[model samples]
Target chain A: MGVSIFGLAWRSLMNRKVSAFLTIFAIALSVALFLGVEKARNAAKDGFDNTISGTELIVGAPSGQINLLLYSVFRLGNATAEISWPTYEAIAARNDVAWAVPISLGDNHRGYRVLGTTQSYFEHYKYGQRQSLAFAEGEMFDDLFDAVIGSEVAKQLGYEVETPLIITHGLGAGGLTDHDNRPFRVVGVLRPTGTPVDQTIHVSLEAITAIHVGWETGARNPLADNIPEETIRGFNLTPRTVTAVFIGLKNRATVLRTRRDLNTNMTEPLLAIIPGQALAELWQVMSTAERVLLAVSAFVIAVGLVSILTSILTSLNERRREMSILRATGARPSHIMTLLIAEAAVLGFMGAVLGAILIQIIFAVAAPILSAQYGVALMGTGPGLVDAYTIGAVTLAALFLGIWPAITALRRSLADGLTVKV
Target chain B: MTQPIVSLSDLSFAWPGQPPVLDVKAFELNRGERLFLRGPSGSGKSTLLGLIAGVLEANSGAVHVLDQDLTELSGGQRDRVRADHLGVIFQMFNLVPYLSVVQNVVLPCRFSKRRLGEVQAAGGAEAEAKRLLARLGLSDEGLLSRNVTELSVGQQQRVAAARALIGNPALIIADEPTSALDADSRDRFIQLLSDEAQKTDAALLFVSHDGALAPLFDRAIDLAEINHAASIMEQA
Candidate 1:
């Protein structure tokens, strides 16, 4: 009996191929959009949350929390004030400090941010909890003049090993101390990390000082030009100040105490923020926008469901004769209702699966672009928990919408049966 | 004498805001009898079929099929009784266009367990459907699996006739079942319906406006004289 009803339903659907296909296509497109938005939103949130999980604290001269997070972790905006190298060294020498990587900012390699830090950065700095830098092609910087480029920088700028690139001394397009005199060679390329580091150009601290050797007190000196490289090195070339320092705690429990101590005891006005806490705060600020996006996607799904109901209900009128025939055959009105409901559920089920597949296709097409533009690495795997939730929710919504049509068909079939001469 | 397979007593029905469409003081069909009901257009012929099949509830008195009072039964029970004891064939749209001929024939068995058991008791329902289709002059190939929409009107009328007799129900109601067919095809359809009714030993109530076909039935009744409401409405 079930088989025959299913066969009847299938044949009925096939009889109106154009209309059925249109309904299914409408549902599939909406499902695809819903899944795509849901995937991107969740991926962005995951990438944001995992940005700096390995590092415990971001230490910088007194600045806003957002600035500290941006500069110390993402290497985005310039630091408002510089922490003296002495302060960085003193903090690094503490017993509770497992490792400290000092960052010197204020340089750019084309559009990519350039960071000057100690070799400890390559050894101890991590993004997603102990995730060390993995070289995709070459080794880390071995020479003071050698540079390690991020995956995005290497790809976008067409840089390879031994590629000579010059650095500018400021963040913007044109600034004083352009540092065109010294050029650095690309020695290594880091693997894609789906973080800001993937878009960075890393150089040794001495390399940073080497490029600015001719500049005296933030200004180019005419007398410094003729001086030999050896003579210029004899001058105090050691950095006087650094932008920020990333500190790794010996014990996870000591982070809060260290943050409090840095806030109160430091002679220099400085702020120390837990990376995870600051990221959560950032997420809180952006959650409203995320929810708005979610609501819009939900609305799209609702519209899709309504279309399904509308199509089914409209077609029910034409189906009156067909349903009456079934009634004459021995089918109860309830049986007719079941057939309609089953057809609707089948449509919803197929739409959800198609939506999931569409998301994978989008990832396949856009992963490379995202990596190049935003350093976001998208993995094309099967549906995850969030994807499953979206599918289940959308399918249930479709089913809910389908109820009206089923009931309408049942009611109309009964009336048609009575009026039918057969 | 045989027991009455269908009995109507003082039945009256009307559309909302209108006078009665049909009123029957008394109507009865004995077992295995073929009765022809003649009526012009809009004489409430379809409504009389509805009353007999328990599809419509009469305003007064009772409609009994196989000694079961349709008015006393619940809606669902009435539907079951209709499925179990009655088979109806409409004029123009008898078969569902999407269903195959055999599928349409086997439809009544799907509703009532009694009808299904009866069809299966003789043979499997599929085999019974095939035999009935064959007897109706449909070829084996035609009976196997062909959509009703593909059939000619004459062929569809034959298929509808086959469907009405498959379960050996106590009564068959055919509402202008041959109106779409040509004269020869109409005569052939009536013969097939009467032969199938005789084979199943079921009473047949055949409604049509064609008075010439009345001689083929065991008894003929003019719906205009039997339905008082239509005569009064015509008089007014």
Candidate 2:
């Protein structure tokens, strides 16, 4: 009466602790689910967008643009054909080309892809806001048999500076494709970039061809018909072809003209694609499903709110005599109405508070596993504008939900204030 | 020279799609007078109280309380009038279960600002509620802190009476409030209610079907003698 209506409503809810807790719990789980999905989707999208920086186009064999982009940058699928080493040299020697990094793929160390590139790859490669690569320990690969592993490869396989590892011939069965005779020393380990590059093993472009020589016979043993490492190194380590090449233009204005020249002027057929544009295409393909997931989570929030409504509605009959007592104590119909609304608003707000708490807990538990599996780093920007809006929307929706029960209580107070049958 | 606290003239009321429940020619309760009206269940006693409290509109004529015509006031205004000038106690389930005994006693002051203002000089609503509860024989320290629902029926009725008298309202209504009490406690409960009313100098309207408890009030009237509609309803 003289006290706050919200206080009265709070007392009423305290009278029924079990139903009130269940209502708030339902809302908290839904809120956590909704925010969790948004965080994961955003993290994945950001990972894709931030993977390649300072590089304009990826050049590969004449094939689909998405295929060329995915195979060259993301290491997703295999290339349709290889770009001859001469063709790579022509692209590198262009007047409009600032620098070019060659890439050869066809092998793996354990499950991680083995990428063959020159020292220029380490110098020119950048990711995540023009960040250059740095070694976690040791230096770049200097010898033909030296290899620098990515952060995830180093961590998962526990490789050290001098650890020697055998490369698989291809993505083949275990023990069969192991180049056990020609194990490469781990010269360095690259720091994590939260990208696909973190899951690769880097070696020199010449080493790819050197390992393939006389290995086409599929020797059953590591020493069977295998030429000595020193002899193969001395016998022309020059590579005949590479899987793809990353072309960085000297002037971004010459991108279109350079691409046209690479397509028509080059002797071998090749395709070039801008990574940013390909990423946009990927988003277009994934956006619909992401929207559906978000909508489903939003529906779950609605269901939680409905439970609030259901609980309040069911309690109305039980509180009839209670309403009559308040009415007899000089509470107006509007007072009864406001008291009921206040109860639900409190529940809604508490649910949102609990939801915020649960989401942070979920993020803390899920962050490491997600980075390890998908390299999607969830940057925890604590309670930004999106969070504010989400909490506000949830509270406002609760206020709206409280209205139905408030109106019902109002009607009862007016119609039967003095004559409550109980 | 003081006006009657409650006055009804040519009042008639009926529920929607039902026969008439109350058709009173004239009823009056003067200032500081305690009046007892005998009306059992289904005898239009609650209907008359509802009209007097301005909770229901009469089909015809005026309901005057605290010298204001209730029929002329808006619903909100009537609610204000009721809060400022009247307090009511029921027969059973008298106390709001969630509130403690002191909070139950101060219930009227929560709605009626005038009552709150009246009790501010007496050390506010809580202190005044404690004073009234002490006077009404419910002064146990442990019982005061207990949940109202856990109190005995006699204790609950005293708490209800303390609540009704807290705001110094011009009129207090006790509608069959002692029917749930045992025969011995019923008389004691009514005596405590009248004592509290006499101390406040507020007109008390005590309605019940129990004729044995009629002698304690200053005036008594049977509903069958005064209410023409009750007789007509009996014939139907």
Candidate 3:
């Protein structure tokens, strides 16, 4: 009446401070994992959804759609074949077609992908709700020897306007050969969009053309045959083939007809696919992984809750005295039950708070790694509306699960006499 | 308008599938009476205390406290009547280990709103608890703040006594509360408890097997002389 039962429960927990602390810790870690996994899942989805949008269809070599999307859009695996220049020209000149941008991927600049495209890429290419790419500094490439670097390339490699960049003949670190003679000038740097585009170095398709003018059979030409960089600009530098093409249709209604025409009626083999379907398929593959992650975290939470149950249940035999003391001092059996249940509820609330703190710590360490490795953006840091709901659910579950031990103590105290053995 | 604090008539009890352990014909402690009942261990003193506290159900006859037949009340009602009326003290482990001395002393009021109301009218439970503990000679501020488990046996017994006497309950049941105290402090403990109980005009039912301390109470009864089942169990 004067001293509150909640206070009594808290003091009782404090009496067993070590066990209580361990319980809170286990619950906090599980909660952090639960919320962290959820954050990563959301970031992965958002990153994929934001990568490239507003394009009606992607056209590429006869390779599978995922492969073509991987190399052209994602810059993941290498493209095994190329679409002829006339095929790209034919798709660009279609009646329903609006514009086309060629993507030629074969070179790398210091671990970043090299993408050769026309000025149409900066003009028409869109991402994340049809947002256009804006230059952070400088402007788009103007000549066959000019290049535009992405935000990460500039930030990581310390490139700025007039920074000379050498394109390697192949992908990855220390590839087959370096294009030392045909080095390009950094003309522009685009702002970060949290997409793979941030990892690309852009140039005119002719820039990809002029670099290999002396090379044959995928190797460097002899020293005598190597053309000097000063005289190479006039040598008919047009791309003969391209890795992929992004096609946007002016008339949205004729996409299927145009795709069918390209896939079935073209002299050159080609593949046209709606990006949404491929993205959905990718999500389907990823969701299974997410489900496994969710199940694992759910079990961890269950283990955390079970530890509370075990802690209380085992303490009951010894706590019989505590319960009897309460009962003898005018407390009823229901008060004892409330005392135990209230203890668990308090621990659960503390667990939620600790979980929030722990999740912020995890996100702080994971954000940059995620952005760099997977291009996923991890945005929020603390508990949100959904997090509050989850905390409530976990706390309520702890309180609910706490009843078994309380009921057990109640039964024993009822059976035992008010006279304590000690 | 004077009435006995507790009256039992033809009470008999036993654990299930066992012989009768307690059978008493008649017993009563009058208003403001301090009665000592001496019974050695295994004489069913604990079972009697449990029944009187409304924590146990008698197999037959009536167990009455505060003029209410405990047999006629539901389990919850009995718990309520106990909370509202009785203040019990065991021989040892009397205080909740986690609570401070004052918290232990005021714990009865947390369960009994009636007692809480009485405490509040007396200028708050903390002040009333301090008054009771001071009477029991445990008024050290440092001592009061420490956990009850850290208190010596004599101090623990005094704290337990103060707890029982806090809300002026209708009946104070102390079962061998001085069993752990030395001879010197045991007598002092009883004097303090009885003096505090008399101030509230609350009846005391003190049970202990030690007969030497029996003279400190207003009256005394021997369990073997009154409980027929004790003699029966001895004979069989």
Candidate 4:
């Protein structure tokens, strides 16, 4: 039986152990970075998709789909117009509407966005497979001044149930209009959903209206500012307007009709958009940035391949004598070529496999940090077909990269023969 | 009636874009003959080995080894002939530094089925390798297990000789194989190599710049007397 050519290749590689390992290490790092970027991108998309998964339609003032999605789901940018209380009630009363949960934004509490909604929000609002929000501690808010904090807000601020926190009138880190007279006590903390909900503080819509009762048109009402907090119960606290409403249709067939009716027949200029379609459109705008990121990562992998070439070419000079020695042992020039190519292939295969393993380890360690920071959950499944393709491509590229050295070695073996000067 | 192990006629070779390096009108080595070829530096000693080993094809004329016309065979066919019928020992690079002594010795068997069969007939390739190493006065198990890098120069040279003698190739080519050994070790190595060649009935073509080792062989030829290209280049 002929001896294994791979056995010869492996022994040759072992002779130059440091260069082989260094080459493998460089390739592994590039693969990890490539896989890491792709994984983060996927996880980010999953987080965005999970944010408002169950809301079939979103109703807000006439605006772009991406704009409405951004302000409604991601809490990005201020709403240009608001839906009045009567309009929201009329929509909620429509026969096609299963539920309409009003969302009142434009408030901040310690850098966390404050979302004011009714008890119906906890009952009807759903995310990530139509799953209802579950409280991690305490129960849903029962009073106008009670607030329920999301997991991230509670964790970041170290707030417990009944921890009093004041609300600021506008969104931002430091808003001048602080509602100091009325502070809401944290009544519940929601479990982590790996969505934007985790970044928001929830309170009753009545509390939102009550907090601004003494103010008029973004300015304070001096006459009511001095009124005692005890007598605030006597004032009317019905919400006048909401930033947007997340609506679920009574039937799947009614979604288009309801969306059209809300846009064309409403008393005010309003727009109703399919949340999924709007999110898709939003993703289109973001895809360009995503493509740029992937391109950069691809260039990084290319650089890694070049390094593989450099490593192999660098060692070819030193291994010239070794090649001639093999020739003297009855190894054909073709065998020398095969040996070099096989060595590169082994390095590439090992580097790719090690990179895949490294990615999983990084995900395992970074999952929590990603959840807490970006609200993205990395599903730690083993390498998929895409990873296999990447590894295969890298291996193939390494083989191509090895050809240069293989040819050089073949030429030197033919030229040098038994009189290898080195 | 037996044919010579090697024969060359009107063999001429040159590097790409250079004048001819070897121009031999005729040369021959009979079976089992130990011939020492001495050449000064730049006298085409290594180039002749290349031609004889079939590693380099002549620009004209025919070179034969064991009745096979090397000029008529493909490059791969030449390699097969080298693997099956010839054993080569270089001045350096005698053993792959990473391979063990036995692995180094059994390398030819790995490439040639004929050689592998010969070793297998003697039990196995590794067994034959050990037997050859034992005859070369390197029988220690510890020495056989060591990486070639850890072996002494004399030990490495012996290992190379054992490798060349394995599978009993019909022809052995030694290009200054003892250049690195001490005087005593070199004499011992040559004696061992001669005995191994005689036992296998393999022709030996040993080339070296040193004339001191020429007395050990059956016959000797100065390359300066045989290669017309060397005299012509010197005159130019």
Candidate 5:
């Protein structure tokens, strides 16, 4: 009996192939968009939360928490104020400090920023928890003049090992050129991290100071130019000030105490923010954008559902004779309703599954560009909890939207049974 | 004849805001009897058929079919009776165009367990449906799986006859079933309908305005002459 009803539904759908195909296409497209939005939303959250993974605290000169997070983890903006080298040394010397990587900013190669830090920056500074830097090609920086470039910098600039690149003195393309006379040789390149690190150029702290040593009285020194590079290296080249410091605690329990001490007794005004808390604060500040995106996607889905309803309702008039025939065949009003409801549910389910598969395909194709350009990695792994929830929600919405027309069909069929005319 | 299978007592019906359409003192249909009900358009011929099939309730009086008062039965029970004991074939659009020929004939069984049981009891439902289709002169090669829309009007009418005759219903109501056919096809349709009705031993109430088909039935009644109140209401 169930088989016959299903056969009837199949035949009815086939009889109106054009309309059925159009309806299925609308459903498929809507499901794709709905699932795509869901995937991007969760991916954004994952990328944001994991931006500074494995780090306990970020210490910088007093500034907005968001700024500190953006610069220290994402490498987006520059630090407004710098912590003196003594402050970094003080923080690094503490008993509870397991590792500290002091970072110096304020330089750029073309548009990409150049970061100056120690070897520990590559070894101990992690993004995703315990995720060490993996070098796709050559080794990490070994000498003062040799540099390690990010994956994006290598791909965009077409730089290979031994390629000489000069640095400018500020954040952007228009920044003042500083290291014009002494270009650094690219030594190694880090693999894609899907973070801002992918777009940065990393050098040693000594190299950062060495590039500035030629300046006397805030002007270029003629004597410094004539001196051979070997002779000039004899001068003290240690950095006096650095942008920020990343601290990893030997024990997790002492992070709070250490943060409090830095806030209280630090000679310079400084702020220590837990990376996770700072990330959450950043997410809160950006919640409006997320909400706007979600609301727009939802509205689009609503429009799609409305189209489905309108199409089905409009076709009801043309199908009057068909409905009457079903009635004459002894199909109850509820049976007619069930056929419609089942069609809608089936369409919604198929659309969702197809949409999710499309999203994963899109992610796979775009992963490389996303890692380089936006520093956001979209993996092609199976759906997570959030993806599942979105598909389920969209399906339910489609079914709910379908009910009105199913009821309409039922009512029309019942009225048709009474009229006895086609 | 045995006790009448259908009896209409003082039946009167009218369209809303219109004059009376049907008012008959009595109408009886005996078991296995073939009756021709002749009436012109707007003479309440189809309305009476509607009442007898319980598709529409009579505004006054009672319609009894198979010894049960149609008016006394609930709407669901009326539907059940129609599904179980009565088969109706309309003039046109009788079959669901999307369904195959055999599927259309098996529709009544889908609705009523009693009809299904009867079909199954007679050497399985499919076998019975095929046998009936064969008797109706439908080709076995195309009859079982052919969509009803693909058949000519004459062929479709024959398929409809077979559908109405399936499950051996106690009564069959055909409303101008051959009106759309040519004269020759109409003759063939009438002969086929009568032969199939005799085989099932079901009372057949065949309604049509064409008097040429009247001789095929055992009895004939002119609805307009028999309905006195219908004419009086029309005059008033």
Candidate 6:
């Protein structure tokens, strides 16, 4: 049988192994970067969307929609204001509300946000297709100082069921007084949800009020030292103010009416947002950055292809004699073009596959860190259809990119057939 | 008696935006004839070979090889004729360096169905390639597998010759095929190439500036004597 032209192309590439490898590596790295960025973007959007999947409305003190979603669901930037206890009560009493999980923030446990809420949070708070939180180890918080820690918080802090979790008076990395005397015990650790909830320490509303009852304003009272945990039940621990209330409507159709009522409250101005719409709005805000990332990666791929073109064109000068040989052996100008195109296609395909393997290796190393720090879970290291599409598009682009050098080779062969310059 | 293997009539050619380089009123090479074409550098030696190979088309008139009027054929049809009926060898030993000696020898058969069919009739492409190489005294088993880059200049020359003579093409065009060889190897190479051409019953046109090689061929034609453009160039 005749030697396949593709086989010839392969042999030609193998002839210049060093340049072929360099070109393949450049293309692979660029493809890896493009694929990595795209995966990270999708993972981030998935994490955000999974944060508060079933919440119908988020009612908070009148604030920006993005801010309310951020502080309430994402545990991102803090809410500028708080919804009053009376306003929260009135909203919770409405017939349209099925269950409301009021969130009282402004506390942290070793940098993980400490969310103060009722048992309703553990019971009704849903995420990722209305999947309720399941404990990885133990049961929900029952005692006054009992804490339900998210999966990441437990993993990072190495907290077990009985580990003493000290709550801080505020949210930042510095200058916050710790409630060391009234430490909470880790009661439960939630399973990985790939959401903000995985990064929070959940405590009851009474604990939020109990920890700061004696602190006058932001200052610690010297006389109110060492309040015993046993006596905490003796004190009234009703939360007077919460940051936001996540409401789930009894009927999905009543969401608009309830939102309008909350927004038009005469007693106190409140902001209500459907969590899904807010998340979509957040995606809108982030889509620009996503597009920029894709654009930059695409530009890098273009640069990689240009480098391939340059390498091939440079080799074309050296291969002028080779082209003449092919011409002498009965190859037409079109055959020369096909040979170059085939070589480039092989390079592109090899690079894409190498890049995919590289990406999987990178994700394997970075997955744990990403989940721990950003709550963005990279579920698996396998390639998806999008990855296949990317490789296909890149290979096709490479075939097209080969035209310049192929044309150059064709012209050279036609001009210098079987002629030795010497 | 048989139609000439190659016939050019009133052929004229020139580089674009340049004066005519070749104006041959008539040129013919009979079947199985070996013709030595002598010309100086820049005297249209390579240009005439290009026209004969169908790589270049004359400005006026026709090049008929194996009874096909190359001027009447489309560029692609001319390529087909070149592939099926003609073999070319260049002076620089243009063996695709990455390919094995066997691979380089069989390359013509890769592009031409007719050549491939001929090789198949001789058992297989590789076998025919090996047969031709052995006829040119390149039968070392190790050398056949080695890349052409590893071969000596003379060995490489034999490989090029084997490639050109593989499929029993009607005509063989050799452009300074021995220019890069030493005198001993040059004579040996020409003997092997001419012997292979005779075995295949193919007409041979060997172009070179060296006049010493002319006596070995069936006939010698000084290109300056026939290319009218050469006389005009000499006058200017």
Q: TM-score of predicted model 1?
A: 0.88
Query: Would candidate 6 be rated incorrect, acceptable, medium or high by CAPRI criteria?
Result: medium
- In angstroms, how far off is A22's CA in candidate 6? 3.5
- The sequence of per-residue lDDT tens digits that candidate 2 reaches over residues A1-422 is 33566778888898989999999999989887888778767877888888888887788899988788777788788887999988989899989999999999978888788999999999888998999999999999999999999998888889989999998888765596677777799999999888888889999988887777767565544454457777887878778888888879989988888888887888898888788888888777788899899999999999988988988999999898889889888898778888888888888888878887888887888877876676566774345566677778888998888889988888877888587875
Clashing residue pairs in candidate 4 are none
Model 5 — TM-score against the truth? 0.87
TM-score of candidate 6 against the unseen true structure: 0.93
lDDT of 5 at A297: 74
Clashing pairs in 2: A1-B110, A2-B110
**lDDT (Cα, tens digit) per residue for candidate 5, span A1-422:** 32366566667767777877776677667666666666776677787776667788999999898899888788887788999998999999999999999999878888888899999998887776567888988888888898999988999889988999998766656434456777899999998776778888999998888877767466567566676788657868789999999999999888899999988888899999899988888888778787787777777767766766776678778777777666665666667777776666655655666667776777777766777667676643457675677668766876787788888887776555534554
- Of 3 and 4, the candidate ahead on TM-score is 3
Cα error of candidate 4 at position B6, Å: 2.2
Tell me model 1's lDDT, rounded to 2 decimals: 0.80
lDDT (10s digit) by residue, model 1, range B1-236: 76698888898888667798888888888999999999887888877887777766778878888888888987677778888888888887777777777777887887778978888788888888888988889876843566778788888888888888877888888988888888888888899889889888889999999999999999999987778896555753
Q: What is the Å distance of residue A409 in model 1 from its true position?
A: 3.7
Candidate 2's C-alpha runs over 4 A off are A1-3, A172-174, A218-226, A380-382, B230-236
For model 1, the superposed segments whose C-alpha errors exceed 4 Å read A1-3, A94-96, A136-138, A152-183, A215-237, A251-254, A264-267, A379-381, A420-422, B118-130, B140-147, B230-236
TM-scores for the candidates: 0.88, 0.94, 0.96, 0.89, 0.87, 0.93
lDDT of 3 by residue, A1-422 (tens): 44588898888888899999999998999988998888778877877777788788898888887777778788898988999998889889988899998889999988888999999999878888899999999998998889998888887789999999899988856545888877799999999988889999999998898888867677887672466765677777778999888989998888889889888999998999878777777788889999999999989989988888887788788888888878877677778889889888888878877887899888988787876766566654446875787689888998998798889988888888686654
Best by TM-score: 3
**Clashes per candidate, residues 3 or more apart or on different chains:** 3, 2, 2, 0, 0, 0
lDDT of 3 by residue, B92-130 (tens): 888888888888888888888898999999999999999
The Cα local distance difference test for each model comes to 0.80, 0.85, 0.86, 0.86, 0.80, 0.86
- In model 3, the runs with Cα more than 4 Å from the true position are A222-226, A379-382, B230-236
Docking quality (DockQ) of candidate 3:
0.71
Considering only N, C-alpha and C atoms within 3 Å, which residue pairs clash in candidate 3? Answer: A1-B109, A1-B110
DockQ of 6: 0.62
Q: Which lDDT tens digits does candidate 4 get at residues B1-236?
A: 78889999998998889888889888999999999999876888889998999888999989999899999999999999998988988886678877888888999888888998998998998888889999999999887878888899899888988888889899999988888888999999999999999999999999998998899999999887777886446754
